[model samples]
Each structure stands twice: as C-alpha cells, then as structure tokens.
Target: MIKHIVMWKLKNPGDAAKFKAQLDSCKGLVPGMREFEAAVRTEGLEANVDVVLVSAFDDRAALQAYLEHPVHVEVSGVLGGLRESRTVLDYET
Candidate 1:
C-alpha cells in the first residue's frame, strides 16, 4: 500500500474551517481512495502547517490515478487559492 501524507499552511489562519471542509470535499470526490483523513491543529501548536491529510492507496498507480483525477484537480484549484505553503510525502508499506 501507499501512504500519501500532505500538510498545508493557509493564507489566512482564520480560514481553517473552510480549508478543512475543502479537504473533506476532496476526499469525498476521490474514487479509489482506500482511506482518507484530515486534521487541523486544534491545540494551537506552533507549526508551519495548519492542516494535515493522510491518505492510503493500493499502490503507486492508484495514487497516481487519484492525483490525475479531475476532482482532485478541482480540489487543488480551491486549495491553491487558500494555501500559502504546502508539503507532501508518499511512501509504501
């Protein structure tokens, strides 16, 4: 399996709710997602990223398919507007 993890820092910290909603929306749109979770730093911890996304896929190809999917593209479009910085990691189990 492949685990795709991502973190994002929003342009406006106050938009946390909106960003999290977008994350859930994106997850709902993904067809082959084996698992998906979104989290926000509720503890007000000092961190560069405001939100985190942890997703699981069957393999690299499935992960790639999700990345190329149109729904994901649309989600990214929304995220691009709201995010100030982003980082990602993909690995296999």
Candidate 2:
C-alpha cells in the first residue's frame, strides 16, 4: 500500500473553506484511490499548514493516476491560487 500525504499553507486560513469544498468534489472521483480525506487545522492548534490531504492507493501507479485525473486538475487550479506554501510525502508500507 502507498500513502500520499500533502499539506498546504494557505495565504489565509479563512479562505481555506473554499478549497475544502473543491477537494470534497474529488471524493470517489480518482481511479485506484482506496481512501481520501481532507481537513484543516483547528483554532489554537498552532498550525503551520492550513489544509491536509491524506490518500491511500495500492501503489505508486495508483497515486500517479490520481495526480493526473481531470478532477484533480480542477482542484489544483483552485488550490494553486489559495496556497502560500505546500509540502508532500509519499511512502509505502
């Protein structure tokens, strides 16, 4: 299994709600994705990242498919404008 995790630091955490809705649109849209989740940091948590996406796939190819999907492309378009910084990690178990 592979886990693909991404964190985004937005220009404003208040604006992140829009990005959350965009990400929710991708639920069950990506091929070969076993699981998908998105969330934002809570108040008083000292969050360095504003949004986080955690996804699971059978392999790297599955992750790649998700990355190349049209739905994801649209999501990226929205996120790109909102993000100030981003971080990502992919690992297998």
Candidate 3:
C-alpha cells in the first residue's frame, strides 16, 4: 500500500477547521482509497502546523488518481491561498 501524509501551516490559524473540512470533502473520491483522515491541531498543542492528512491507497497509481481527481483539485484550490507552508510525504508500506 501507499501512504500519503501532508501537513500544512495556515496563513490564519483560525481557518484550520475550514481547511480540514475542505480536505474531508475529498474522502472516497476514488477507488482503491484504503483510508483517509484529516484533522486540525489540538487546542493547546505546541504544534506549528494547522492541519494534517493521513491517507492510504492500494498503490502508487491509486494515489496518483486521487491527486489528479477533480475533487482533490478543488480542495487544493481552497488550500492554496490559506496555507502559508505545506509538507508532504509518500511511501510504500
């Protein structure tokens, strides 16, 4: 399986919830999506990132399909202006 993880630091921390919700809207967008989860930072945590996503796919092709899907493109559009910084990791497991 392929695991795709991403963390984002928002331009406005208050928008974290909205960003996470937008990401959640992409769940089940394509076949071979094993798992999808999005969450905002904890209230009193010493974290710098505002939002995080942890998703798993059957393989690289499945992961690619999800990235190229229109639903994901829309989510990316919403995140583009709101995020100050973003980091991503993908690996086979």
Report lDDT per candidate: 0.85, 0.87, 0.94
From the highest TM-score down, the ranking of the candidates is: 3, 2, 1
Specify the poorest-scoring 10-residue window by lDDT in model 3.
41-50
Best by lDDT: 3
Error of 1 at 30 (Å): 4.6
Residue 12 Cα positional deviation in candidate 2, in Å, after optimal superposition:
1.6
Task: Please count the clashing residue pairs in each candidate, in the order shown.
Answer: 0, 0, 0
For model 2, state the Cα shift of residue 55 in Å. 0.8
Question: In model 2, what are the clashing residue pairs, if there are any?
Answer: none
TM-score of each: 0.88, 0.92, 0.96
* Residue-wise C-alpha lDDT for candidate 2, range 1-93, written one tens digit per residue: 999899999998798788888888887875678989999889987878889999899888888888888988988987899999989999998
Best by TM-score: 3
Candidate 2's displacement at residue 73, Å, is 0.9
